[model samples]
Target: MLPVGHFAGPMFIAPDAVEPESYEVRYEDGVFSLSAAEYAVWALAHGDPDRVGSHRPTRQALTAEAEATGVTEPAVTIDALISDGLLALIEDEPAARRAFAERHQLMPLALGLGNQPSQLGVFQIGMPNTPRVSVGYDIYHMWLFCHRERTLWAAVQEIAGEAQEANDAAPAGDVELIADVDDLLAGLIEALPILLSTSCGFLDPRRPSPTSAPADDAAGSGDDGRGEDPAEDHEHGGDALVAQP
Candidate 1:
């Protein structure tokens, strides 16, 4: 349990779906779906409690949320979000800084500064029920040159490019193939940020979840041959890159 005495403390939210009505948080390889009110309570950690319009972790804030959402018990909702790992108590600003720092490695990769997979670079991330990305090579596995090591952005661009190329080879006005191309393109674009973050250890390693199992059975499962091929659905099956949301 996090001690809430420190007003300056902030916590980390997992790589989650921050939707208006609900939140899907992936932590320790498990997916937690939070109610709107609960999500509101958890969102308090994103900023200062004393800030205007930002959420504050307190009974008064809970009352207002309860009145707005009709949850009837905001305290219970808050407790549930806290315990479920969708929201965490960051302890202090220093800890908060470290948590945020860990996520910084993602920006560079997301902005198209990455390398190709000369050797297979497999990155399996996201919780089981949330967004999961599995990247691998079908064949031609060799040592990847440091200048061309696989990066999330590069992989997405590569697979998506191949898919586009396939669609181009298809006859003109081929609506089905074109639509499939669009889905692959859109999926890859959506997957870029999340995959990059996952590669950079998007989840705070310090915050352990009770529902989580050994990492060998969790996110690590992404690299295993037993898992489904991420790029199997793509028409151009030359590359193995898949992202699911």
Candidate 2:
């Protein structure tokens, strides 16, 4: 089975609908049999879907509900639920599942700097000697440049011209020629990842399900292809252009 955090993709089912049967959780050893309700509780508390809230149940609420339902121990029920993947536990009460979804719906892209140009440009432009720009950087600029590269370049040229004129008119070192360079780069970086992630087919489309086989057996029938590792193929299949900032 895939490791817990390795499957960080969004849950395909709604939080309420994530019962144990919704997934097929298996163990490498032969000692566990988790029910649907149990799986649902466990997933809510421990799976990637539960990361936003860490799946912690409210103690007081759980106690009250358990008492009303005639259950002797609410904690035991909660533990059972966790084992089955039905519920989750989080550190902060304010960051429950609902709140977590509200706060962190998207996966953070590899880009680290802020979205502003002053922050993003230093990485996008690079040294100019490389043939292909970093995929990550190019993806951002390409999105911003969509149907407007010429116009954008023209604007940059105009700005550069203005900067040049200011430098010529002023005393030496008076004009900072690279003043707007930061902004220019940021604009490009801001848009690249959105474009690439959405359009470039770099990310896997399949939901990370436990039932999924490691590889497509039909496609890898021949000896030469059969010996190759599926995991390595998946990792290196794309040209993930890495740019050094």
Q: Rate the local accuracy (lDDT) of all candidates.
A: 0.33, 0.31
lDDT per residue as tens, model 2, 20-46 = 222233221111233322222323222
Measured with C-alpha atoms, the lDDT of residue 36 in candidate 2 is: 29
Which 10-residue window in model 1 sums to the lowest lDDT?
Answer: 138-147
| Clash count list over all predictions | 0, 33
**Candidate 2 TM-score, true structure as reference:** 0.21
TM-score, model 1 to reference:
0.29
- Runs in model 1 deviating more than 4 A are 1-23, 43-69, 91-203, 207-245
Q: After superposition, how far is residue 154 of candidate 1 from its true place, in Å?
A: 28
